[model samples]
Target: KFCNETSDEVDRREHPNKHFICSFADCKATFSKLWKLEAHYSRHTGLKPFACGDCEKSFCTRYQLTRHHLSHSGEKPYLCSVSGCSDAFSTPGSLRNHAAHVHHQKENSYVCNHQGCGKEFRKKKQLKFHICEHTNELPFECDFEGCNDKFASSKALKRHWKMHKGYPCDEEYCNFKGKTWSEYQKHKKTAHRVTLPCDQCKKMFHNAWFLQKHKQSVHSGERRMFKCIREGCEKSYTTNFNLQNHILVFHEGKHDFACPFAGCGKAFAMEESLKRHFVVHKPQKTKLQVNLCDGCSMCFLIHYILEMLL
Candidate 1:
Protein backbone atom coordinates (compact mmCIF):
# COMPACT_ATOMS: atom_id res chain seq x y z
CA LYS A 1 0.00 0.00 0.00
CA PHE A 2 1.15 3.63 -0.65
CA CYS A 3 0.64 4.63 3.06
CA ASN A 4 2.88 1.81 4.24
CA GLU A 5 5.62 2.85 1.79
CA THR A 6 5.52 6.51 3.00
CA SER A 7 5.84 5.40 6.65
CA ASP A 8 8.89 3.25 5.76
CA GLU A 9 10.55 6.25 4.04
CA VAL A 10 9.95 8.44 7.12
CA ASP A 11 11.49 5.81 9.40
CA ARG A 12 14.57 5.61 7.15
CA ARG A 13 15.15 9.38 7.27
CA GLU A 14 14.63 9.79 11.06
CA HIS A 15 17.67 9.90 13.44
CA PRO A 16 17.91 8.23 16.84
CA ASN A 17 16.42 11.34 18.56
CA LYS A 18 13.59 11.63 16.01
CA HIS A 19 15.14 14.73 14.46
CA PHE A 20 15.30 15.28 10.69
CA ILE A 21 18.50 16.25 8.80
CA CYS A 22 19.09 19.03 6.27
CA SER A 23 18.93 17.82 2.62
CA PHE A 24 21.57 20.37 1.45
CA ALA A 25 24.78 18.69 0.29
CA ASP A 26 27.82 18.89 2.69
CA CYS A 27 25.48 20.10 5.52
CA LYS A 28 24.75 18.14 8.67
CA ALA A 29 22.40 20.58 10.43
CA THR A 30 19.56 18.88 12.39
CA PHE A 31 16.00 20.18 12.55
CA SER A 32 12.83 18.94 14.14
CA LYS A 33 10.74 19.78 11.09
CA LEU A 34 11.17 20.30 7.38
CA TRP A 35 10.22 24.04 7.65
CA LYS A 36 12.91 24.52 10.30
CA LEU A 37 15.47 23.14 7.86
CA GLU A 38 14.25 25.55 5.17
CA ALA A 39 14.51 28.48 7.61
CA HIS A 40 18.10 27.54 8.64
CA TYR A 41 19.22 27.16 4.98
CA SER A 42 18.08 30.70 4.33
CA ARG A 43 20.96 31.83 6.63
CA HIS A 44 23.48 30.35 4.17
CA THR A 45 21.81 32.37 1.41
CA GLY A 46 22.53 35.72 3.23
CA LEU A 47 19.04 36.47 4.46
CA LYS A 48 19.34 39.00 7.36
CA PRO A 49 16.57 41.31 8.55
CA PHE A 50 17.05 41.93 12.25
CA ALA A 51 18.55 45.36 13.28
CA CYS A 52 19.60 47.08 16.50
CA GLY A 53 17.90 50.31 17.59
CA ASP A 54 21.01 51.92 19.15
CA CYS A 55 23.50 51.59 16.28
CA GLU A 56 21.49 50.21 13.34
CA LYS A 57 23.62 47.04 13.47
CA SER A 58 21.99 44.14 11.63
CA PHE A 59 22.13 40.43 12.26
CA CYS A 60 20.60 37.37 10.68
CA THR A 61 19.27 35.97 13.96
CA ARG A 62 17.59 37.36 17.10
CA TYR A 63 20.16 35.48 19.25
CA GLN A 64 22.95 37.41 17.56
CA LEU A 65 21.19 40.70 18.34
CA THR A 66 20.83 39.66 21.99
CA ARG A 67 24.56 38.97 22.16
CA HIS A 68 25.44 42.28 20.47
CA HIS A 69 23.30 44.30 22.90
CA LEU A 70 25.60 43.23 25.75
CA SER A 71 28.49 45.02 24.02
CA HIS A 72 26.44 48.21 23.63
CA SER A 73 25.25 48.33 27.21
CA GLY A 74 28.51 47.13 28.71
CA GLU A 75 26.52 44.42 30.44
CA LYS A 76 28.71 41.54 31.47
CA PRO A 77 26.14 39.00 32.53
CA TYR A 78 28.46 36.02 32.43
CA LEU A 79 30.75 35.59 35.42
CA CYS A 80 33.71 33.41 36.31
CA SER A 81 33.55 31.41 39.55
CA VAL A 82 37.28 31.77 40.29
CA SER A 83 38.66 32.16 43.81
CA GLY A 84 40.37 35.56 43.82
CA CYS A 85 38.58 37.28 40.96
CA SER A 86 34.93 38.16 40.37
CA ASP A 87 35.28 39.18 36.75
CA ALA A 88 32.12 39.36 34.67
CA PHE A 89 31.93 39.00 30.91
CA SER A 90 29.41 39.52 28.11
CA THR A 91 29.49 35.96 26.89
CA PRO A 92 30.07 32.49 28.31
CA GLY A 93 33.03 32.05 25.93
CA SER A 94 34.74 35.14 27.32
CA LEU A 95 34.06 34.02 30.90
CA ARG A 96 35.73 30.71 30.18
CA ASN A 97 38.69 32.52 28.63
CA HIS A 98 39.13 34.75 31.74
CA ALA A 99 39.00 31.74 34.05
CA ALA A 100 41.65 29.94 32.06
CA HIS A 101 43.90 33.00 31.72
CA VAL A 102 43.64 34.53 35.19
CA HIS A 103 42.19 32.00 37.64
CA HIS A 104 43.47 28.59 36.59
CA GLN A 105 46.80 29.67 35.07
CA LYS A 106 46.41 27.34 32.12
CA GLU A 107 49.06 25.09 30.60
CA ASN A 108 50.13 27.82 28.14
CA SER A 109 50.98 30.26 30.91
CA TYR A 110 54.63 31.39 31.09
CA VAL A 111 56.67 30.52 34.21
CA CYS A 112 60.01 31.97 35.35
CA ASN A 113 62.78 29.36 35.29
CA HIS A 114 65.25 31.44 37.32
CA GLN A 115 66.65 29.59 40.37
CA GLY A 116 65.24 30.65 43.73
CA CYS A 117 62.42 32.41 41.91
CA GLY A 118 59.37 30.20 41.60
CA LYS A 119 57.03 32.86 40.25
CA GLU A 120 54.42 31.96 37.63
CA PHE A 121 52.30 34.37 35.66
CA ARG A 122 49.48 34.09 33.16
CA LYS A 123 50.66 36.85 30.82
CA LYS A 124 53.85 37.07 28.74
CA LYS A 125 54.18 40.75 29.65
CA GLN A 126 54.59 39.93 33.35
CA LEU A 127 57.08 37.19 32.53
CA LYS A 128 59.23 39.63 30.56
CA PHE A 129 59.61 41.82 33.65
CA HIS A 130 60.78 38.85 35.70
CA ILE A 131 63.28 37.83 33.00
CA CYS A 132 65.10 41.15 33.44
CA GLU A 133 66.47 39.95 36.79
CA HIS A 134 67.93 36.74 35.37
CA THR A 135 69.63 38.60 32.51
CA ASN A 136 71.06 41.33 34.83
CA GLU A 137 69.66 43.95 32.48
CA LEU A 138 69.67 47.46 33.97
CA PRO A 139 67.40 49.46 31.73
CA PHE A 140 67.83 52.60 33.84
CA GLU A 141 71.28 53.93 34.84
CA CYS A 142 72.49 57.14 36.51
CA ASP A 143 74.93 59.28 34.56
CA PHE A 144 76.39 61.05 37.60
CA GLU A 145 80.04 60.67 38.50
CA GLY A 146 80.87 58.30 41.41
CA CYS A 147 77.33 56.96 41.12
CA ASN A 148 77.06 53.56 39.52
CA ASP A 149 73.67 52.42 40.74
CA LYS A 150 71.25 51.08 38.15
CA PHE A 151 67.49 50.80 38.53
CA ALA A 152 64.67 48.98 36.85
CA SER A 153 62.99 52.21 35.81
CA SER A 154 64.33 55.61 34.81
CA LYS A 155 62.14 57.48 37.31
CA ALA A 156 63.65 55.57 40.24
CA LEU A 157 67.19 56.36 39.08
CA LYS A 158 66.32 60.04 38.70
CA ARG A 159 64.93 60.19 42.25
CA HIS A 160 67.97 58.37 43.66
CA TRP A 161 70.45 60.83 42.11
CA LYS A 162 68.74 63.82 43.74
CA MET A 163 70.31 62.73 47.06
CA HIS A 164 73.64 64.18 45.94
CA LYS A 165 72.16 67.71 45.93
CA GLY A 166 71.72 69.52 49.25
CA TYR A 167 68.16 70.32 50.33
CA PRO A 168 67.19 73.54 52.18
CA CYS A 169 66.11 73.69 55.84
CA ASP A 170 63.02 75.77 56.64
CA GLU A 171 64.02 76.96 60.11
CA GLU A 172 65.53 80.24 61.39
CA TYR A 173 69.18 80.05 62.58
CA CYS A 174 69.27 76.39 61.58
CA ASN A 175 71.42 75.09 58.72
CA PHE A 176 70.50 71.54 57.81
CA LYS A 177 70.31 69.40 54.64
CA GLY A 178 68.29 66.42 53.39
CA LYS A 179 67.86 64.28 50.32
CA THR A 180 64.70 66.13 49.23
CA TRP A 181 63.03 69.44 49.92
CA SER A 182 60.04 67.85 51.63
CA GLU A 183 62.32 65.64 53.75
CA TYR A 184 64.40 68.69 54.71
CA GLN A 185 61.34 70.56 55.87
CA LYS A 186 60.15 67.58 57.86
CA HIS A 187 63.52 67.18 59.58
CA LYS A 188 63.71 70.89 60.33
CA LYS A 189 60.35 70.81 62.08
CA THR A 190 60.67 67.46 63.83
CA ALA A 191 64.41 67.08 64.57
CA HIS A 192 66.48 70.28 64.22
CA ARG A 193 64.19 73.31 64.81
CA VAL A 194 60.47 73.72 64.51
CA THR A 195 59.58 76.65 62.22
CA LEU A 196 55.87 75.88 61.85
CA PRO A 197 53.89 77.49 64.68
CA CYS A 198 51.10 75.57 66.38
CA ASP A 199 47.60 76.46 65.22
CA GLN A 200 45.99 76.13 68.65
CA CYS A 201 48.55 78.36 70.50
CA LYS A 202 51.01 80.84 68.98
CA LYS A 203 54.06 79.16 70.54
CA MET A 204 57.41 78.34 68.91
CA PHE A 205 59.82 75.54 69.80
CA HIS A 206 63.05 74.14 68.48
CA ASN A 207 61.46 70.77 67.54
CA ALA A 208 58.25 68.80 67.77
CA TRP A 209 59.57 66.74 70.69
CA PHE A 210 60.12 69.92 72.75
CA LEU A 211 56.80 71.34 71.59
CA GLN A 212 54.96 68.16 72.63
CA LYS A 213 56.69 68.21 76.00
CA HIS A 214 55.71 71.88 76.46
CA LYS A 215 52.10 71.14 75.63
CA GLN A 216 51.85 68.15 77.98
CA SER A 217 53.58 69.90 80.89
CA VAL A 218 52.31 73.48 80.57
CA HIS A 219 49.06 73.46 78.62
CA SER A 220 47.63 70.01 79.40
CA GLY A 221 48.40 70.18 83.16
CA GLU A 222 48.51 66.36 83.37
CA ARG A 223 51.81 66.15 85.32
CA ARG A 224 53.20 68.98 87.45
CA MET A 225 56.66 68.82 89.00
CA PHE A 226 57.45 72.55 88.82
CA LYS A 227 54.71 73.65 91.22
CA CYS A 228 53.87 77.29 91.86
CA ILE A 229 55.13 78.68 95.16
CA ARG A 230 51.56 79.86 95.90
CA GLU A 231 49.46 77.42 97.95
CA GLY A 232 46.70 75.11 96.52
CA CYS A 233 48.31 74.69 93.05
CA GLU A 234 49.38 71.23 91.91
CA LYS A 235 51.83 71.00 88.95
CA SER A 236 54.61 68.64 87.86
CA TYR A 237 57.01 67.98 84.96
CA THR A 238 58.69 64.83 83.59
CA THR A 239 62.13 66.37 83.22
CA ASN A 240 64.09 69.61 83.70
CA PHE A 241 63.84 70.29 79.95
CA ASN A 242 60.07 70.36 80.28
CA LEU A 243 60.35 72.43 83.50
CA GLN A 244 62.37 75.08 81.65
CA ASN A 245 59.73 75.19 78.87
CA HIS A 246 57.00 75.61 81.48
CA ILE A 247 58.80 78.57 83.08
CA LEU A 248 59.32 80.26 79.69
CA VAL A 249 55.72 79.77 78.52
CA PHE A 250 53.71 80.19 81.77
CA HIS A 251 55.65 82.42 84.19
CA GLU A 252 56.96 84.92 81.56
CA GLY A 253 59.68 85.86 84.10
CA LYS A 254 63.03 87.24 82.89
CA HIS A 255 66.26 85.65 84.21
CA ASP A 256 69.61 87.44 84.81
CA PHE A 257 70.09 87.61 81.01
CA ALA A 258 68.73 91.07 80.22
CA CYS A 259 69.49 93.68 77.54
CA PRO A 260 72.65 95.65 78.25
CA PHE A 261 72.85 98.50 75.69
CA ALA A 262 70.57 101.49 76.15
CA GLY A 263 67.39 101.37 74.00
CA CYS A 264 68.36 97.84 72.79
CA GLY A 265 65.38 95.50 73.39
CA LYS A 266 67.38 92.24 72.92
CA ALA A 267 68.46 89.76 75.61
CA PHE A 268 71.78 87.85 75.88
CA ALA A 269 72.42 84.33 77.16
CA MET A 270 74.38 85.64 80.18
CA GLU A 271 74.85 88.90 82.14
CA GLU A 272 78.63 89.06 81.72
CA SER A 273 78.30 88.45 77.97
CA LEU A 274 75.73 91.23 77.87
CA LYS A 275 78.12 93.50 79.78
CA ARG A 276 81.00 92.67 77.44
CA HIS A 277 78.73 93.37 74.46
CA PHE A 278 77.60 96.69 75.95
CA VAL A 279 81.24 97.90 75.95
CA VAL A 280 80.91 98.42 72.18
CA HIS A 281 78.19 101.04 72.83
CA LYS A 282 78.91 104.65 73.92
CA PRO A 283 77.53 104.18 77.46
CA GLN A 284 76.72 101.18 79.69
CA LYS A 285 75.12 100.30 83.04
CA THR A 286 77.56 101.41 85.80
CA LYS A 287 76.11 99.44 88.74
CA LEU A 288 79.02 96.99 89.00
CA GLN A 289 78.20 94.82 92.09
CA VAL A 290 81.16 92.85 93.62
CA ASN A 291 81.19 89.86 95.94
CA LEU A 292 82.38 90.58 99.53
CA CYS A 293 81.85 87.05 100.83
CA ASP A 294 83.30 84.30 98.64
CA GLY A 295 81.22 81.60 100.38
CA CYS A 296 77.91 83.45 100.60
CA SER A 297 77.94 85.16 97.18
CA MET A 298 78.47 82.26 94.87
CA CYS A 299 76.54 83.83 91.93
CA PHE A 300 78.62 85.42 89.19
CA LEU A 301 77.88 87.64 86.16
CA ILE A 302 77.81 84.72 83.68
CA HIS A 303 77.26 80.96 83.85
CA TYR A 304 80.89 80.32 82.83
CA ILE A 305 82.07 82.83 85.43
CA LEU A 306 79.92 81.16 88.08
CA GLU A 307 81.40 77.77 87.18
CA MET A 308 84.93 79.12 87.53
CA LEU A 309 84.12 80.97 90.78
CA LEU A 310 82.66 77.83 92.37
Candidate 2:
Protein backbone atom coordinates (compact mmCIF):
# COMPACT_ATOMS: atom_id res chain seq x y z
CA LYS A 1 0.00 0.00 0.00
CA PHE A 2 1.20 3.49 -0.89
CA CYS A 3 0.75 6.49 1.44
CA ASN A 4 -0.51 9.75 -0.02
CA GLU A 5 -2.49 12.95 0.59
CA THR A 6 -5.53 10.84 1.41
CA SER A 7 -3.51 8.29 3.46
CA ASP A 8 -5.21 5.42 1.63
CA GLU A 9 -4.21 1.77 1.09
CA VAL A 10 -3.84 2.04 -2.65
CA ASP A 11 -3.66 -1.68 -3.36
CA ARG A 12 -5.97 -4.56 -3.96
CA ARG A 13 -5.05 -8.25 -4.26
CA GLU A 14 -7.42 -9.92 -6.75
CA HIS A 15 -7.71 -13.44 -8.15
CA PRO A 16 -5.46 -12.87 -11.18
CA ASN A 17 -2.95 -10.23 -9.95
CA LYS A 18 -2.14 -7.82 -7.17
CA HIS A 19 -2.72 -4.16 -8.02
CA PHE A 20 -0.55 -1.56 -6.25
CA ILE A 21 -1.76 1.90 -7.15
CA CYS A 22 0.01 5.27 -7.13
CA SER A 23 -1.62 7.73 -4.71
CA PHE A 24 -0.61 10.93 -6.56
CA ALA A 25 -3.41 13.39 -7.36
CA ASP A 26 -3.54 12.81 -11.12
CA CYS A 27 -1.50 9.57 -11.40
CA LYS A 28 -3.65 6.43 -11.55
CA ALA A 29 -0.97 3.90 -12.57
CA THR A 30 -1.37 0.46 -10.98
CA PHE A 31 1.32 -2.19 -10.76
CA SER A 32 1.28 -5.93 -10.04
CA LYS A 33 3.69 -5.68 -7.14
CA LEU A 34 4.85 -3.28 -4.40
CA TRP A 35 8.33 -2.93 -5.93
CA LYS A 36 6.87 -1.93 -9.30
CA LEU A 37 4.73 0.69 -7.53
CA GLU A 38 7.83 1.94 -5.69
CA ALA A 39 9.75 2.13 -8.98
CA HIS A 40 6.89 3.98 -10.69
CA TYR A 41 6.62 6.38 -7.72
CA SER A 42 10.34 7.25 -8.08
CA ARG A 43 9.56 8.66 -11.53
CA HIS A 44 7.40 11.29 -9.77
CA THR A 45 9.95 11.90 -6.95
CA GLY A 46 13.06 12.40 -9.21
CA LEU A 47 14.84 9.72 -7.21
CA LYS A 48 17.45 8.03 -9.40
CA PRO A 49 19.20 5.59 -7.04
CA PHE A 50 21.17 3.78 -9.76
CA ALA A 51 24.30 5.80 -10.61
CA CYS A 52 27.19 5.26 -13.06
CA GLY A 53 30.65 5.33 -11.40
CA ASP A 54 32.36 6.61 -14.60
CA CYS A 55 29.95 9.52 -15.15
CA GLU A 56 27.41 11.82 -13.44
CA LYS A 57 24.58 9.90 -15.14
CA SER A 58 21.93 8.20 -13.03
CA PHE A 59 18.94 6.04 -13.83
CA CYS A 60 15.77 4.94 -12.05
CA THR A 61 16.32 1.25 -12.99
CA ARG A 62 19.35 -1.03 -12.68
CA TYR A 63 18.72 -2.34 -16.22
CA GLN A 64 19.11 1.22 -17.56
CA LEU A 65 22.26 1.61 -15.47
CA THR A 66 23.63 -1.61 -16.96
CA ARG A 67 22.89 -0.34 -20.48
CA HIS A 68 24.66 2.98 -19.68
CA HIS A 69 27.76 1.12 -18.42
CA LEU A 70 27.99 -0.72 -21.77
CA SER A 71 28.70 2.65 -23.52
CA HIS A 72 31.83 3.18 -21.37
CA SER A 73 33.05 -0.45 -21.53
CA GLY A 74 32.52 -0.78 -25.34
CA GLU A 75 31.36 -4.37 -24.77
CA LYS A 76 28.98 -5.86 -27.32
CA PRO A 77 28.09 -9.34 -26.10
CA TYR A 78 25.49 -10.04 -28.79
CA LEU A 79 26.93 -10.75 -32.26
CA CYS A 80 25.50 -11.49 -35.66
CA SER A 81 26.43 -15.10 -36.57
CA VAL A 82 25.03 -14.57 -40.09
CA SER A 83 27.40 -14.72 -43.12
CA GLY A 84 30.41 -12.72 -44.39
CA CYS A 85 31.16 -10.04 -41.76
CA SER A 86 31.52 -10.25 -38.00
CA ASP A 87 29.42 -7.63 -36.15
CA ALA A 88 28.88 -7.33 -32.39
CA PHE A 89 26.19 -5.65 -30.30
CA SER A 90 25.49 -4.91 -26.63
CA THR A 91 21.94 -6.32 -26.85
CA PRO A 92 20.34 -8.97 -29.08
CA GLY A 93 18.02 -6.32 -30.54
CA SER A 94 20.90 -4.02 -31.62
CA LEU A 95 22.68 -6.86 -33.47
CA ARG A 96 19.48 -7.61 -35.40
CA ASN A 97 18.64 -3.89 -35.86
CA HIS A 98 22.06 -2.95 -37.29
CA ALA A 99 21.96 -5.89 -39.76
CA ALA A 100 19.15 -4.19 -41.72
CA HIS A 101 21.13 -0.91 -41.96
CA VAL A 102 24.58 -2.48 -42.53
CA HIS A 103 24.86 -6.17 -43.59
CA HIS A 104 22.36 -9.05 -44.22
CA GLN A 105 20.68 -7.03 -47.02
CA LYS A 106 19.02 -10.13 -48.54
CA GLU A 107 17.08 -11.97 -45.79
CA ASN A 108 15.12 -9.19 -44.03
CA SER A 109 11.89 -8.29 -45.82
CA TYR A 110 10.94 -5.60 -43.28
CA VAL A 111 10.84 -2.65 -45.67
CA CYS A 112 8.68 0.45 -45.88
CA ASN A 113 6.16 -0.05 -48.72
CA HIS A 114 5.05 3.60 -48.67
CA GLN A 115 5.30 5.20 -52.12
CA GLY A 116 8.77 6.78 -52.64
CA CYS A 117 9.61 6.21 -48.93
CA GLY A 118 11.33 2.83 -49.21
CA LYS A 119 13.26 2.48 -45.94
CA GLU A 120 14.40 -0.99 -44.78
CA PHE A 121 14.07 -2.22 -41.22
CA ARG A 122 15.23 -5.33 -39.29
CA LYS A 123 11.84 -5.97 -37.76
CA LYS A 124 8.15 -5.45 -38.54
CA LYS A 125 7.77 -3.42 -35.30
CA GLN A 126 10.31 -0.86 -36.57
CA LEU A 127 8.48 -0.57 -39.88
CA LYS A 128 5.13 -0.26 -38.08
CA PHE A 129 6.42 2.58 -35.85
CA HIS A 130 7.94 4.34 -38.89
CA ILE A 131 4.60 4.07 -40.74
CA CYS A 132 3.00 6.16 -37.97
CA GLU A 133 5.18 9.12 -39.03
CA HIS A 134 3.53 9.03 -42.49
CA THR A 135 0.10 8.24 -40.98
CA ASN A 136 0.45 11.00 -38.33
CA GLU A 137 -1.12 8.61 -35.84
CA LEU A 138 -0.20 9.20 -32.22
CA PRO A 139 -1.06 6.02 -30.26
CA PHE A 140 0.08 7.00 -26.76
CA GLU A 141 -2.25 9.35 -24.91
CA CYS A 142 -2.35 10.90 -21.45
CA ASP A 143 -5.03 9.26 -19.27
CA PHE A 144 -5.40 12.36 -17.11
CA GLU A 145 -8.89 13.86 -17.05
CA GLY A 146 -9.50 16.92 -19.28
CA CYS A 147 -6.15 16.28 -21.02
CA ASN A 148 -6.33 15.11 -24.64
CA ASP A 149 -2.58 15.00 -25.10
CA LYS A 150 -1.22 12.34 -27.54
CA PHE A 151 2.26 11.05 -28.41
CA ALA A 152 3.78 8.89 -31.17
CA SER A 153 5.72 6.77 -28.68
CA SER A 154 5.07 5.46 -25.17
CA LYS A 155 8.49 6.79 -24.09
CA ALA A 156 7.52 10.31 -25.24
CA LEU A 157 4.19 10.04 -23.42
CA LYS A 158 6.01 8.89 -20.27
CA ARG A 159 8.37 11.87 -20.54
CA HIS A 160 5.40 14.21 -21.13
CA TRP A 161 3.73 12.77 -17.99
CA LYS A 162 6.27 14.79 -15.97
CA MET A 163 3.96 17.78 -16.55
CA HIS A 164 0.97 15.87 -15.14
CA LYS A 165 2.89 14.04 -12.36
CA GLY A 166 5.97 15.95 -11.26
CA TYR A 167 8.88 14.85 -9.10
CA PRO A 168 8.57 16.36 -5.65
CA CYS A 169 11.43 18.49 -4.25
CA ASP A 170 13.73 16.63 -1.85
CA GLU A 171 13.87 19.70 0.36
CA GLU A 172 11.35 19.28 3.18
CA TYR A 173 10.19 22.90 3.30
CA CYS A 174 9.84 23.21 -0.49
CA ASN A 175 6.48 22.14 -1.92
CA PHE A 176 7.55 22.59 -5.55
CA LYS A 177 6.86 19.57 -7.77
CA GLY A 178 7.48 21.07 -11.21
CA LYS A 179 4.91 20.95 -14.01
CA THR A 180 7.58 20.19 -16.67
CA TRP A 181 11.05 18.57 -16.97
CA SER A 182 12.79 21.96 -17.24
CA GLU A 183 10.77 23.35 -14.36
CA TYR A 184 11.58 20.31 -12.19
CA GLN A 185 15.26 20.42 -13.16
CA LYS A 186 15.42 24.12 -12.26
CA HIS A 187 13.39 23.49 -9.10
CA LYS A 188 15.79 20.69 -8.07
CA LYS A 189 18.72 23.04 -8.64
CA THR A 190 17.15 25.99 -6.81
CA ALA A 191 15.31 24.14 -4.03
CA HIS A 192 16.99 20.74 -3.47
CA ARG A 193 20.61 19.79 -2.65
CA VAL A 194 20.79 17.22 -5.50
CA THR A 195 22.94 19.23 -7.93
CA LEU A 196 26.01 21.42 -7.36
CA PRO A 197 25.17 24.35 -5.07
CA CYS A 198 25.10 27.84 -6.59
CA ASP A 199 27.64 30.21 -5.01
CA GLN A 200 25.31 33.22 -5.03
CA CYS A 201 21.95 31.72 -4.03
CA LYS A 202 23.24 28.37 -2.57
CA LYS A 203 20.91 26.39 -4.89
CA MET A 204 21.53 22.83 -6.19
CA PHE A 205 21.33 21.29 -9.70
CA HIS A 206 21.28 17.55 -10.49
CA ASN A 207 22.90 17.97 -13.91
CA ALA A 208 25.22 20.43 -15.68
CA TRP A 209 22.74 20.95 -18.52
CA PHE A 210 20.15 22.42 -16.14
CA LEU A 211 22.81 24.52 -14.38
CA GLN A 212 23.94 26.04 -17.70
CA LYS A 213 20.35 26.70 -18.80
CA HIS A 214 19.58 28.28 -15.38
CA LYS A 215 22.62 30.54 -15.66
CA GLN A 216 21.72 31.56 -19.22
CA SER A 217 18.01 32.15 -18.49
CA VAL A 218 18.08 33.46 -14.91
CA HIS A 219 21.51 34.57 -13.66
CA SER A 220 23.59 35.50 -16.72
CA GLY A 221 23.29 38.96 -18.28
CA GLU A 222 24.62 37.89 -21.71
CA ARG A 223 21.41 36.30 -22.93
CA ARG A 224 21.30 34.48 -26.28
CA MET A 225 18.49 35.81 -28.48
CA PHE A 226 17.27 35.31 -32.07
CA LYS A 227 15.61 38.69 -32.43
CA CYS A 228 13.28 39.41 -35.35
CA ILE A 229 14.74 42.67 -36.69
CA ARG A 230 11.57 43.78 -38.43
CA GLU A 231 10.45 47.43 -38.90
CA GLY A 232 7.89 47.45 -36.05
CA CYS A 233 8.25 43.92 -34.58
CA GLU A 234 9.81 43.69 -31.09
CA LYS A 235 9.59 39.89 -30.98
CA SER A 236 12.74 37.96 -30.01
CA TYR A 237 13.35 34.23 -29.53
CA THR A 238 15.75 32.27 -27.35
CA THR A 239 16.50 29.65 -30.02
CA ASN A 240 17.14 29.95 -33.78
CA PHE A 241 14.52 27.22 -34.44
CA ASN A 242 11.86 29.50 -32.98
CA LEU A 243 13.25 32.48 -34.95
CA GLN A 244 13.02 30.46 -38.21
CA ASN A 245 9.51 29.34 -37.24
CA HIS A 246 8.42 32.95 -36.56
CA ILE A 247 9.87 34.06 -39.91
CA LEU A 248 8.19 31.22 -41.82
CA VAL A 249 4.78 31.34 -40.07
CA PHE A 250 4.18 35.08 -39.56
CA HIS A 251 6.90 37.08 -41.33
CA GLU A 252 7.05 35.31 -44.73
CA GLY A 253 3.78 33.32 -44.66
CA LYS A 254 5.42 30.77 -46.96
CA HIS A 255 3.04 27.97 -47.95
CA ASP A 256 5.73 25.58 -49.20
CA PHE A 257 3.82 22.39 -48.29
CA ALA A 258 0.13 22.71 -49.10
CA CYS A 259 -2.73 20.27 -49.85
CA PRO A 260 -2.41 18.87 -53.39
CA PHE A 261 -6.17 19.25 -54.04
CA ALA A 262 -6.92 22.12 -56.45
CA GLY A 263 -7.98 25.50 -54.90
CA CYS A 264 -7.10 24.10 -51.42
CA GLY A 265 -4.28 26.18 -49.96
CA LYS A 266 -4.37 24.38 -46.59
CA ALA A 267 -0.71 24.81 -45.64
CA PHE A 268 1.24 22.57 -43.29
CA ALA A 269 4.27 23.49 -41.20
CA MET A 270 5.81 20.03 -41.66
CA GLU A 271 6.46 17.77 -44.66
CA GLU A 272 5.09 14.80 -42.66
CA SER A 273 1.70 16.53 -42.64
CA LEU A 274 1.90 16.92 -46.43
CA LYS A 275 2.50 13.13 -46.68
CA ARG A 276 -0.49 12.35 -44.40
CA HIS A 277 -2.68 14.73 -46.41
CA PHE A 278 -1.92 12.56 -49.47
CA VAL A 279 -4.08 9.86 -47.85
CA VAL A 280 -7.03 12.28 -48.04
CA HIS A 281 -6.34 12.95 -51.72
CA LYS A 282 -6.01 9.25 -52.67
CA PRO A 283 -9.16 7.35 -53.55
CA GLN A 284 -9.90 4.76 -50.85
CA LYS A 285 -9.83 1.21 -52.28
CA THR A 286 -11.50 -0.23 -49.18
CA LYS A 287 -14.27 1.75 -47.48
CA LEU A 288 -12.65 3.13 -44.32
CA GLN A 289 -15.14 3.73 -41.52
CA VAL A 290 -14.87 7.24 -40.10
CA ASN A 291 -16.66 9.27 -37.45
CA LEU A 292 -17.74 12.90 -37.73
CA CYS A 293 -16.98 15.29 -34.90
CA ASP A 294 -20.26 16.66 -33.53
CA GLY A 295 -18.73 20.07 -32.85
CA CYS A 296 -17.13 20.77 -36.25
CA SER A 297 -18.49 17.89 -38.44
CA MET A 298 -14.89 16.99 -39.32
CA CYS A 299 -14.41 13.31 -40.28
CA PHE A 300 -11.72 11.19 -38.57
CA LEU A 301 -10.48 7.62 -39.16
CA ILE A 302 -12.36 5.02 -37.11
CA HIS A 303 -9.31 3.70 -35.21
CA TYR A 304 -8.24 7.28 -34.43
CA ILE A 305 -11.75 8.09 -33.27
CA LEU A 306 -11.84 4.96 -31.09
CA GLU A 307 -8.46 5.83 -29.61
CA MET A 308 -9.66 9.36 -28.79
CA LEU A 309 -13.05 8.26 -27.47
CA LEU A 310 -11.63 5.51 -25.30
**Candidate 2 clashing pairs, residues 3+ apart or interchain:** 44-167, 189-204, 195-205
Please, what's the RMSD in Å of model 1? 36.4
TM-score of each: 0.27, 0.33
1-310: candidate 1 lDDT, tens digit per residue: 4465554356456544546665666555676665566557554443445566554244656777789787656588887676667778889887877877777545467889889887888788778766877898978888888888877666567688778766756456767778786787578556863264555577655434344434543466454234444345455544333344345445665454677457877664333445555644543554443332243322233343332222
Candidate 1 clashing pairs? 194-206, 224-235, 224-236, 225-235, 225-236, 225-237
lDDT score, candidate 1, position 170 = 46
By TM-score, the best candidate is 2
lDDT of 2 by residue, 1-310 (tens): 4345232332343323645678887665777776677677676665666766654455766777888787656588887877776878787667766877787445556889889999998788778888988898989989998899888778678888877777776566877777766777677656564545655555566545445444544566564566787778888865444555577778788657778789777887544346556666664853565555453223445555333321
Error of 1 at 51 (Å): 2.2
